[model samples]
Target chain A: MTDKTPHDWLNEHGDYLYRFALARLRDTHLAEDAVQETLLAAIKSPSFEGKSAPRTWLTGILKHKIIDIIRKQGVEQPAEDMSQYAAEEDPADEFFNERGHWADRPLAWPAAENALEQKQFLSVLQRCIERLPPKLARLFLLREVHEEDNESICKELQISPTNAWVMLYRARMGLRQCLELHWLGK
Target chain B: MLSCKQASELLSQSLDRPLTRRERWALRLHLWICAACRRFGRQLMLIRLAVGKVVAETEQNENLRLSPEARLRMTRALESGQ
Candidate 1:
């Protein structure tokens, strides 16, 4: 394969890299900075022997860049208020009755098959993710989107293992309900 | 019998880690008897699958892109670094 110039790299991989960062950072400026830094680092590194696809190599660099930003931001930002999560009134209460049975039975989603191939379905999913409470969205994205392990997520968020589990459960519950309402038409 | 609330939490937790044998049995039993909880579990699994697809497609998604200004700024930065 022939060598591509910096301009070529920017034209090809810029948006993909930017979106990858934006999903994790949730800040447009931070995502832009990350993509810029990743590209710059890729340009400077001597290790690109052209063995792997350029996008894959660049994504490898971008992943580390994202981790660094998450670590740095973790220190700079104050701990998120988790008291609401610890309250006695569980969010799950909305779905369960006094007997702990489903207050509203979940309807089977017949449309779920091949839904991923539909752009509209994906956009609805994205909207549901955006609608999530900020803390829940972050935790969900870290675990599901970035594929971070539970231990590392708890450490990064300064939450205990139990809290992490509870938070993740809440996130999934929220997303499931959102999809059911909007996409499943329930 | 595990309540639907408890069983649902276990279903979500099972995504992240291995469940204890007792927890697994309780969940299985609940799922066996509870159609609603079974539907919930299936939907949760579908959501996970959908999320994986969404992440993969975000790269090629036309709606999500770097602004032209950001792209130009990145280009200038790259050029100066050379």
Candidate 2:
């Protein structure tokens, strides 16, 4: 319960913290600012009793800081346009095709593996990922690319363990289907 | 004893290695009879392996080519008074 306790927390956790912020914010300056504000707020809290790990505690503060930053930046979606990302496809049509299959019989694993080896495939993949919704894209980037664990991913995404699993599933499915349409010559 | 929905849930759960023995059994039984689930599993496998490979290549190239200034900044923040 010392005044400088949060300083120590930041010092210990800043790398993890910065990466978290940068990945979410996609801007170095903003992430740096978020980390600074998080440190300031965490130090002043009576709740900084170290009940949880310092990393977890600091990340919790950063999460809210991110939300506030996003809000102040007027990142809200128009209510009418909100469903654009949410309205992907008719689930019945997607999961169950007219011919009664997953609809797109995906190419072989090695075909995609070969795609991975090529520079052009990567360019294509990046383009597709950029088009992903922020939440879903972040989740996909973390879980699939960054190799984050289910527990860490769930906490970061602020979802139920089950919901995290579901979201991760969708992220994988969406990214693949999108990339397939874009690159795999479906 | 698992329903089709539960069996479907087990499909991903099994992939994650967190399924109970009973759930695993139910999923296996379902996949044995349901070509749909089998195809679904293949899709998941292909997608995962493909994505994993893509991640490896991109990760190698991305951090390697970070602008020197951005690299300096991240490095400095990491080393500062910690």
* Best by the TM-score measure: 1
| TM-score on alpha carbons, each prediction | 0.82, 0.54
DockQ of 1: 0.67
Q: What proportion of the real contacts between chains A and B does each prediction keep?
A: 0.81, 0.13
- The whole-model C-alpha lDDT of candidate 1 against the native structure comes to 0.79
lDDT (C-alpha, whole model) for all candidates: 0.79, 0.58
Off by over 4 Å in 1: A1-8, A23-27, A43-46, A49-51, A70-82, A117-120, A152-159, B79-82
Candidate 1's residue-wise lDDT over B1-82, tens digit each?
8999999999999988789999999999999988988888888888888887776776666798989899889889988998
> Can you write out model 2's per-residue Cα lDDT over A1-186, one digit (the tens) per residue?
534454465545665666676655555666677777777676567787745577777878887786555545443233323354447543334644554455555454345456556766666666776777765555555555444466754554455566556555555566667767777667
List ranges where model 2 is wrong by over 4 Å.
A1-93, A97-115, A118-120, A145-148, B1-9, B15-17, B34-36, B62-82
Clashes of 2: 0
